[model samples]
Target: MQKGSFIGIDFGTTNTSVVRVFNDEHGYKTVNLGEGGDYPFSSIVAIPRQNGGSLKFGRDIKNHREELSSDYEIFTSMKSFLGTNKEFKVGDHRYSATEITTLFLKYIKDYISRTHPDVDLSKAGLSFPVDFSPEARRELRTAAENAGIKVNSFLSESTAAYFANRKAGQAFSKVMVLDWGGGTFDISILELKKNSITETAVFGERVGGDDIDFALAKRVHAEIIKKSEVYNPVAFEDMNLASKDYLISWCEKAKIEISNTEDDYESAIYNYGMYGTKSITVSVNLFNGVVEPIIKSRIRKAVDAALGRANLKPASIDAIVIVGGSSNLASYEEAITNIFKDSQVILPDKPQWSTAEGAALMQIIGGNFKLNNSLGLYLSDGSIFPILKEGEHGVGSVIETLSFSLTEDTQDAHFNFANEDGVMFERATIPTKGYLNEIIRLSARIDDDQIARIQLYNNSMGDLQHSKPTNVEVNKLTFYYDISGLK
Candidate 1:
């Protein structure tokens, strides 16, 4: 095992998957760790303290939620809160969300280290939401660094899925990635052109499986409230005795059963209660005439919103890749197919493994790079930076900025300009869908006046910028800042 064999970690909201490149008799294969597989790690985390000290981490934490007091910080859905500058309350000591996330990551790292005692983990690739900002990425990097892993770079979820598909022998020219994760949803259209992949536009919303689960829980509670008042005719307090976990677990199981059953099941047990020595089942129903529409509506709106953002009439996309655990539902996939008419939405083999596998491939390929063609500049070598002015929306006009870097003793670095097609976003007239129309076009000018500026800064003197390595590229050096919304 080399010191820096890039490991891909898809630390998701509902489930976490770790993938590493492994060499076997069948050649190199991406190994995905699941339960009971030599390396057993669950995303579930429990922070119960002994003698008032918080439990560091484990699957045991979520299992003991009802038994733990306020002192025990049993947390799930931490993935939803990433990039949000919020502090978590665990007993009297409060830690930022980023800090809590790092703790969980540390737990995973320790688990891996113990499993692979001989391997050195210097470089790791982390997966993030498509909508994450540069600041959010910096925070993620900081968290991973604190957890004792040196994060090499950040990979967008769709980007990771894209690579995963490629590794599985699926090829495409222009693709659309529809990812509905546990806590976040994102849709992106990418172009695979001229030996490079470019993400054209990305639309992300904080709505996914977790939101659906919450909706189900709320609906079940309401139904229980109504049923208890009419059927039991006792104090309302007595009817609330069932544990929340039992209800949610039953509901989850009921959901799975409904998705799998060929015959229409009429009723479902919402919760199971223990009475002295025996357990009793509290049932609910998906076939119930009243609540089915509520569940359907949520799923419908989310899907419509995702497709709308891609600005693609379903027929235009070459292929729509379904990702995230929620996409497994037969109903959801059917809905997507119905919406697209003739186009096909292919679910990659091992849908859950797609993102992590893709991320590992991204680690080998590096990121998408495009020349800043908007800036009409004729440059031989150096660094490029965009200057900006604050506008009404946020950052507006593009102003030229200065950048400096070090050149090697014998190598010459060539400065290149790369730009992506600009996106024009316009809100749709319809209220149900979040947003509408967007157009993508590559606009570059060869004129010397509009070219983006590139100037190299060197800490080590002697004016050696011209003599540096010519093999060096500006994917690392050029900085892109969108100034459209600003004044």
Candidate 2:
């Protein structure tokens, strides 16, 4: 651990990991914090029942699971609701998703500070999903800042994973990153060149490992009730909150066990309090059956959609890189291999930590910034005039000037900002009077900050080349960028 080095924080839905990358004589190196036992700890927080009791996080919540729904108010998957209006009510305090996330991150910062006293946690690169909205990115950044951490930049999880793999000597011309974590499934089609990596297409869904865990838990609960010897066994839905939460936890563990075991069947036994003890045999076939409708179908469609958006076919992909915790499942490998039979499928070492490691690597290598969505204008004929096409420019000023004549007398010139997909997300207006054939110059540029700045110059008022801008409007569209030089 060195001072002034940038750390990478993969603040995930179900788990969070942090890695510090710094340059030495040998080159870039990374050291995993929270080492020994809990390197990639659980993404969970629990509020104590008592007023003075300290809030619990990560392995603390796991070690005290039975007391969660009863003794403490538990919050998980806070990242999924980053930009939403979701709130958690605990006692007289209501916590927003951002607030809860801040608490969790502060805990992480403190934990690292205590473990590695000499390391600087001031600046770090954070990883987010490609499909995360601008609002979500803003909220995530705010949370980190609130937690005493300065965000250096944001990197997409898929891109981070690619960087990690590439550093490990896994190279490909065009690659698809299948990132199936605990809370989301993201597919990214990227074009890799010697100096840069371009994201061609990205698709994501909220469904993930948590969904599968719940589905499997319900299935197992049904089986348990059927074989119960009690006079009147309660259904899984009717069960108490603690019981249901405990069952879900058990099911998650069982799912992992089933995936890791080589035996034909793995037995999971649990006690449902008054409902008596029950045991169910789980096999690969049974696990697949429970998750087929939930996991397999969705990923296939998402992958296809990503490919279609990129205007690429299955054969066009040179390799498929699998990253994230849930990607370790055998079913995920089978499903991906089945679809991209001709493409090479690679599962990197320690797939769960790949994203965080990649984020750390990005801080070292530097990256280019690109627009995630197109910025353009709407024409009078219901068509779009692209001012700055998405993914065309990076990290500099791009100016586009177009001249248009007024068809008739108009007091105001309306500019509707649209994307290449024909969706108008914003509009701007310039107040100027002009008659027929009077030319107006519209100047548009995406600055280094990714803000679309548009200005209008009315030739009728003064010299067309020397006149000042009549009006300027800024459209806060979404833009994606990676970390720049850190040395």
Candidate 3:
């Protein structure tokens, strides 16, 4: 690595930011590169000419969203679509998912190289969702390599934010990092003492800023139908279809407006050439009333699941730090404030930048701040296992079928047969036997796009007052067989 400062690139769902750790005449500081010296929208490669010749990347892409859509190429929010089977098309040309991401990453690399010609591009740390599958991480690594940067490590988004917050001078023993980003929402409960971070538990849902946008867009459709004077449903549909770009753009703005306002709202609606449009103001109460419960349900469930996994009481949490674009919503902030009435909810400045900034902070802290001894598992015997016993170090055996959400279905997901907690099982190949009275921790690769979820001891604890239901989507499912006794 070069002696010069390194860069922290937070390639987010809605935006991307690049932060450099540099020392000037005054001292050390982290400077954000791009618009107004702050985070830049994570958009790149927009086609400008209706015929498609040159493409616009980054901030420039957003500036020319309209014209570029006509002739040039526009690839915005490509991050959220990663790992999906979707492809980007400009004119008649189609690109594979990873190729699209590469072009964007290359733009960032070129920007950095232009700004700091002498800095080393090798050994860069990339950030991914904590629950990202091994396959997804590999794709990201490949993307960075294609961008001409040698990736040294890939850390979870919340893990990066945890260290970033610590570097910014916040300290806690049991800190809950609630990172709601542009594309994903992850809540990580860390048993932090002094400067070290021990991840006690982690839970995440695919719901995020994109979901919020979708929700708001639905609301806008309803509002327009209710208020449009020329409201011919078929006509309106045709217009919107013809000018899909305009409706989407407007929906983006409406989402922002709802995020900023708390009262009934009104705005002149612009009509796309195909979608005949007019203006309408939505009652503040109407928008909030409809979306509030949905938002609360998701956030509460995710946060509670992580807390429940850690087996910690509400009072045990010392601080709750909300990170990500969705976390900035006043409704979310108010909800957290209401839950942890006594504990403060810390929201970082330029909230979206925290994860990438945190990743850089991890560079300074090294291996000490990570999850140690945390194991994932699957059952080998045709017996039910318990989740965890009261005060038990690990999940205890229960009498029910175990549900495992495997990400890639890889070898790392297997466990050596064990029935006891003290005996550490050695790594073995497939067709392994399960043991009785033995405890094993297993982690697996379930699929190409999703993270692996192993079924540990099942906990049939009765409903606790603070227990929140989590909504997770699993792409692959498997069962646990307790072959512990057989082995």
How many clashes show up per model?
35, 0, 65
lDDT per residue for candidate 2 within 159-271, as digits (tens), equals 77877776432367788998889888877787766556667777777778888888888888887877777788777788887778888887787777777774445455555
**Cα TM-score of candidate 1:** 0.66
Q: How many angstroms is residue 467 displaced in model 1 relative to the true structure, after the best TM-score fit?
A: 36
lDDT of 3 by residue, 1-487 (tens): 1234656667777777666655334534566665434556455566443453655577775555665565665565666666666876756678765787787888777776677676555556667776665556667777778888776445567766765676443456677888887677887777654434566666767777666555665566666665545445543344443255555556556666777765555676555453346676666566566557766888778777777767786678888888887776677787887877767567787777777766554444332221133222325653323232212222122223434433343322344332223222233332212322232233332222223333332122234421222212232111121111110
Best of the candidates, TM-score = 2
**Model 3 stretches with alpha carbons more than 4 Å out:** 1-4, 23-28, 48-52, 115-123, 167-170, 229-245, 257-266, 273-275, 368-371, 374-487
Candidate 1, 145-259: lDDT as tens digits: 8988887545667667766774322356657777777777766666654454555545566766666565565555555555453453433233343354445544555555555
Off by over 4 Å in 1: 1-4, 22-27, 38-42, 49-58, 62-65, 68-71, 118-120, 167-171, 226-250, 256-311, 371-487
lDDT of each: 0.52, 0.75, 0.57
| Full ranking by TM-score | 2, 3, 1
Higher-ranked by lDDT: 1 or 3: 3
Instruction: State residue 62's C-alpha deviation in candidate 1, in Å.
Output: 4.2
Order the numbered candidates by lDDT, best leading.
2, 3, 1
lDDT of 3: 0.57
